[model samples]
Target chain A: MADQKDGNDRKTTVLEDLKGLKEVVKVKTQEQVEELKKPQETQLYRSIFRIKHDEEPRNRALSTLNNLFFHIHPAKVNRDATRYGYTWGLGGITFYLFIVLVFTGVMLMFYYHPTKVQAFRDILYLENDVPFGRLLRNMHRWAAHLMVMAVWLHMFRVFMSGSYKRPREFNWCVGVLLMVLTLLLSFTGYLLPDDQLGFWAVTVGTNMARATPLLGHQGPFGPQLGMTPYNDVRFALLGGSIVDANALLRAYIWHCIAIPLIASVFMGVHFWRVRKDGGISGPSPVMLESEAKN
Target chain B: MFGDWHQLWVIISTPDNIPIVAMLGLVPFFTWFAFHNMLANDRLIAQLEADPQLARTHHRTTYPYNSRWERELHTNPFLMRKELLAAIIITIILMVWALTLNAPLEEPANASVTMNPAKAPWYFLGLQEMLEYFDPWIAGVLVPTLIIIGLMAIPYIDANPLGNGYYTYHQRRHAVWTFLIGFEAIWLVLVCIGTFIRGPGFMWYWPTQTWDPDRVEFNVNRNLDQILGINGSWISHILPTAWRPEAAIIARALWGIIPMVVYGVLAALFIHWICKRSAYSRKIYSKMSIIQTVTMYIFLITMLFVPVTIFLRLVFRIKYIWETPWFSI
Candidate 1:
């Protein structure tokens, strides 16, 4: 009789445990379902508002932007468009244009100047004077600004996508170089006005140049490095041992012509390689989580 | 006017001065040589055509062999439309702008009088900024040399074919961020320090400390003048000290060995961290990291903002800030 009683209790306990396990499993599954459903929220907003409400006009605008000529990249590249945490995505094209600007810029420099006395006049001459002057200068300026915008967007896009991963490492390096070139191009071109702004900038800029190793002869390693002999490179660059009229002309030549040529060559290689390699990186998992629901 | 074979030594030694002598020396020699070569060619062609084996062989004429890709490329406008379009757009814009706005030309080149600020071309601003922060040896010479050499050696270093952009970052998580952050850091720091941190001498009109301007002036004149005497008063007199705060400390601590020490430490730390976290061998990490770091550094330098802002501000003279870290004067 006692053994039967104990057996009855044991059976009841087993039944209760089974019921508890079932409940737990149901809850866990429900939680996963909720997790899976979370991503659809943004899609709902996107479809309900941004896409649905203005679908026609927006789509048309996008189409225009994506056309072969005016547009820099696909209107909608990768969703990884704004991650500061990493770098990748739309940055490639920005670098490409920068290179293009540099190239055409150098060619344009066969006739350009950044001097108050001659800059504006030179522009007049280049346009009305040089055979293809007008077209070349405009293209260089436009491309430079466009490259700046592209590079900024590209950086933001990379940051958003979090594509700055292990394997795509060196391309990041290329991106950095492109960014520097963009700014340099802008800075040098700024002086072409030969206005007050141009004058001040060149003055500041040359001051900085003079700080160069062995050339500046002021830094820790300048004296130690034996950069004295190659001082002529600096002198020639400055157009004198000091920054004078020769310096201004030299800067003008370099800003307008010399460096642009070099930049163009490198830019070409960079872009060709970028296309040869591939387009932008796809979105990361974290980024996809928000999108996956839709 | 000309030397014969016997006097060839005199002609060779003073080659530049022997303008008439050169013509005299070459005229007869070339005249004789041309006849000999023309005659020799005739003999050789005759010998070849006369050969029994050549005569027996069927004479085959061949047209130029070109690939379909090449032939199609010649006619196909769409083949390189993107590049061509880019080029055209660039050309059109530059030409118009140049025509509308002519850049100034300063007075004909003179080296005596120095300008207030002297700068290199736009592309070189980053390097120019580097000269401001670190020793020019490191910034102007060594660092640039290393970057170029390193760039050339990229293919040999990172041989991994795993992620060429197809896979998501999750697949190659370690490599991506490492490249981005590391590159961004080096570039940002170098560019920022190069541009932003001009010596305090150039930053404000007066020293902040209670020290006498006269004493400071005397000291600067005594020590600084000697170092910078060669460039003279026109440019160097107005410029800031080449050294920055970090530079002085780094210079003193390492005795010219600081940069290398810093680079070594960072490299070792990076490799160790990567290895410990991923269980990947050091060899793999080193390869990926080298490409990753160099690439990042380049990218980071490209994004440098201080110099760009300074350049733009200087150009426009928009006095956005009345007082800046440097250039109060």
Candidate 2:
């Protein structure tokens, strides 16, 4: 204790000596800063970017809120949320795959068009003609597939963790919406290549949609509802009775724009609600061991 | 014949307007209800402040602290680091995979020349496989819808509240095992079969056998009519002449329906027995609502039914208990 006090006294004495040196040098330490700033402006916080370094606690407290990208995070969070073993960050990877898809998709669009006539040729050109077009297409295709897997696994994680309780119910619904949207996005993108596998896969898929009980024509109660080829749900989707140029254009528009827009709206709500609902569901140490035993 | 005025009125009025009508009517009610609750809460708080004894009596007890973490340790520096590491690892893996494999691009589509045994994508392969056994209405439409809705509704319908915020398979064994067996074992296994085991004309292929284009296999379905002797029955003779032919066909179909009816009857009796027992079974069974009880039995029966039906189909070559032009469910 005595040695620590002696060290502190020495530190204070050195600081006092620096004060004298500061006066002698008077090297624009305070006066220059004041002169540089407008009289109406304050001395601190005078920089364009928040360049001022505050105390550690205050700085850390405001770090999330002060930044644009980090605002999704709560100002306060539980230690349980930081534990890497609890959740495998599947949800984050799903979002990352979405980002990867968009980036590669936009680049691929530069070399392609959504028409039956040009779609196949565009793919060939991408593979044999354009530089790294194959890589771009591959990345997009693999990432879209990965996103579906990630979203499903994310839902599994959330369900197993039992995180969708009470106040979190609404967010859970949003998450399910996002999952369906993810699948829809992948489904719509499946036909853009216009290959046999893509074509038949979509044909089988939309054919299933045509059996949607009451809503679809070829489905149960469809004939009773007076559904015909021209008026059925599948026709509305394909924009014709068959998968033609119109179908290609419809898939492209949905994959590129509509689904992404809806997914973004749900994602924004999901993140904000997660923050508002105290940042990820986790067990707190406050529970009694007896209660835990049950 | 029934294009009457009232029927036309009901068709024109009720088909599309119900949803819009409901929404328009409920908006103001919900708005008012929100405000009413807020003001009521405020008034209650003021009243509590004015009288301590009544407030104490009304509150009755302290709120339970169920959380298991401390607040001071919830910062994100460690989490952010971990997230960054995961992203970097994933990016490397994705880059490696993209370089290693090319996306599948089969020959340009020809609608006239449909690919042999054309299949849906991997995710829907399980549903497609089921279409071999059941009607399109059930396998393709109803099953997928039920599975999706059931998954979403589980957290709401589950009776146990002990498994939240932790991984406790021991505590939630019933829930976990049901999901794993029903979805992973049955559905995903079917998907694997659909992907690898099936070949041209949807014929089962051994792994040793190469799927040759020239392979010829016939899938002749043997229904109850064929199995039970489509010879005219005694009931056909007793029935009126107009119904005689149809009655014989119905008697043949009844052979397939016998097992299903017996199974349902036995299950119902077993549940009734449980409700009368003097143990945990009785407690849980009696407490279950009608919907809950029915759902439990339905879930168990369906899980058992799939394997049994598949067994009968493969072993006995029984096709359908009931058949129609549109379905054979």
Candidate 3:
């Protein structure tokens, strides 16, 4: 009788233990659900974004100012500056095309080999074998061409708007350098395919280097200065007398690395100066000829 | 004629030539768009200038304005949105372009096989076209360098303060006309000529004419000195026998220099006359420093030289205006 009483007592204790455990689990799960419901309140989200994305003007301004990439832009811009008719967005388009070029160019670099024998074959293989390789190459080429056109138009627009006047003059000079770099970038990339078109085109191009005054073998007084096919500006440019394997490698490096680096530096200065020089040169209050300071 | 059209189509349809083809349309459209805005702004300026009361209260832009509205907008939503839209549109266009047209890849580069009428990439074709008129040193090297310098010099040389941040043809007439003539009439036109006109052997072919690789024309090019019958031997007549050879070179160089100097002086006088033509222009000209005026004259004269040389080449068949053993211009 005593043993049966002990067993009943033990059973009651076990049931009580199980119920206590279930209650604790239920409360903990509820807490977790409450936490997930307010994800914006989470530490991770707060750490990355820094500011809440609300409809407040402060947040809107912070969104541009705090971001790494978007910081290139000012928090607020002139209402007229946003108009499509004013800037035609050519400068921005040129920059966008440059970004496109860099992306596609990097992808292209994976398939290309800058050697005489393999260079042409690699392009062939890319066109035929690799997935979307032709698309990559086409995008790069077309974007490059588009970029050149855009740069020219940007300069044209700037000139027409008189945006290069006053304190903006230095920026204009930087812009001119950027334009030159853009052309150089395109010219260097042109020789990478190593096809007949590129070969002849580059040959014709580098041939002109042979006529660089005081540097080229065939230029005025170049011979008198000891310039020759073996050692002259053209030789220095191509790494030899002709556009061959070395020229291919040289062009590859310049197109991929050197000019891009230089261009990026110039572009940084150009943008910074634009802000320093008082934003996009207007569609501001037009100054009359009578108001002109003599 | 139909075959000629086909031939032209073949050239235009080539994948590499596509950019130049696009340029033909885009350049003219943008130019027209710019001029249209410029003229509208000019009319507005005229209206504003006529009435002081209206000028005092005017918003000064072509777009409609309201007093209640803010002068500025948040870049995040306004400018950024447009930029995003532009980026998306350009991406779509690029994607479509990539999908539809395959990038050109000709037979592997063969040094042994030269491309008939070998051309540089389309952008450099203007320089190549200039090669027909000037020596490689002048056309290929010097002109390109000068163009870069001239572009950089514009802001410094432009002393007129009338059209500081806006487009008004009347206010900045000289600047606008100079740029238009330099960019549209010369650079873009030369690019067109290089792309469409030059054919096999780099010879000029009318749009309707078929490119015949074997066609040859008589060479009628003559140097300026030769055209004037100023022989080196004739010039050597006044010098001792020992100094005769050197004197001939000196004489020829002097002859070349004379015409060049004459052209320069004439171009400068014309530019000066134009600058002083109007009362407003004179007011602006008076604002310029001596350095600015001279720099402007140099650039304007150099710019005019391109067309002058082109005319001489095409019409007069003159090869070299300034020719020496070392260099020819």
Residues A1-294, candidate 2, lDDT per residue (tens digit)? 323324554545667667567454564556667666654244454442352345466666566667677667665665555655456578888888888888999999999899888898899999888999888888888777677667766776676666775557778878988887987898788888888877887787777667767667878788789877667888888888777788899999999999999999999999889878767876422221123321
lDDT of 3 by residue, B111-135 (tens): 9999988998888899999988898
lDDT of 3: 0.89
* TM of each candidate vs. truth: 0.41, 0.75, 0.95
Give lDDT tens digits, candidate 2, residues B1-329.
22244533442243122222332343334334323433443454446556767665553112222345344442446466777888898799788767977777878876777777677665567788887777666787787766666666665555455445655443354565566567556765676667656666776765445555677766566776566566447668777889786885556555546656787777667646644554433444555677776776766566656666666776876777555444465
Where does candidate 3 stray beyond 4 Å? A1-39, B1-3, B232-234, B245-248
Q: Candidate 1: where is the Cα deviation over 4 Å?
A: A1-116, A120-145, A148-187, A203-231, A252-294, B1-133, B144-156, B189-270, B281-329
- Alpha carbon lDDT of residue A133, candidate 1? 72
lDDT of each residue in A1-294, candidate 3, tens digit only: 323324555545667667567666777789879988988777888899899888899999999999999998899999899988989999999999999999988998888889887998999888899999999999999999999999999999999999999989999999999999999999998889998898998998889888999999999889999999989999988999888999999999999999999999999999999989989998878878788886
Compose the digit string of candidate 1's lDDT tens values, residues B252-297: 3333233334544665565557655653334355555565655644
User: What's the lDDT for all of these models?
Assistant: 0.45, 0.67, 0.89
Better of 1 and 2 by TM-score: 2
- Candidate DockQ values, in order, are 0.04, 0.21, 0.74
Task: Give per-residue lDDT, candidate 1, residue B80.
Answer: 28
- How high is the TM-score of chain A in each model? 0.49, 0.79, 0.90
lDDT at A72, model 1: 35
